[model samples]
Target: MKRDSCQQRIYAVRRVGLAIDRAARATSKIDKRQAARWATAWGVACGVRQF
Candidate 1:
């Protein structure tokens, strides 16, 4: 609930989201699968219960 904490969370999500996006754009199928896994981790880090 603190101001700095909220900003830090936003920054963390942005970093993870960017990595997942880059992975998603890879031409190899393996990369895409890896990206899917990263997405789950990212979701968990962002406090998403279900997606």
Candidate 2:
């Protein structure tokens, strides 16, 4: 089945979050939880609800 726009956007945001998380892990800058929080914040700012 085809996903909706919002789902696609969320998936993109998650991909970004994973990238950030991986980069941070590589550099030991931050943890996965922090990365997830940042992604959630971005999503909320972009008006993506249902979190």
Worst 10 residues of 1 by lDDT: 42-51
Candidate 1 Cα deviation (angstroms), residue 13:
1.9
lDDT, candidate 2, 1-51, per-residue tens: 998877877776776666566646754445666675666666664465445
Candidate 2 deviant stretches above 4 angstroms: 27-51
* Number of backbone-clashing residue pairs for each candidate, in the order shown: 0, 0
TM-score of 1: 0.59
| Most TM-score-accurate candidate | 1
| Lowest summed lDDT window (length 10), candidate 2 | 42-51
Model 1 agreement with the true structure over 1-51: per-residue lDDT tens digits: 555867776765886787678786889988888877776776666665355
- On lDDT, the candidate that comes out on top is 1
Q: Which stretches of candidate 1 lie over 4 Å from their true place?
A: 1-4
In candidate 2, how many clashes are counted? 0
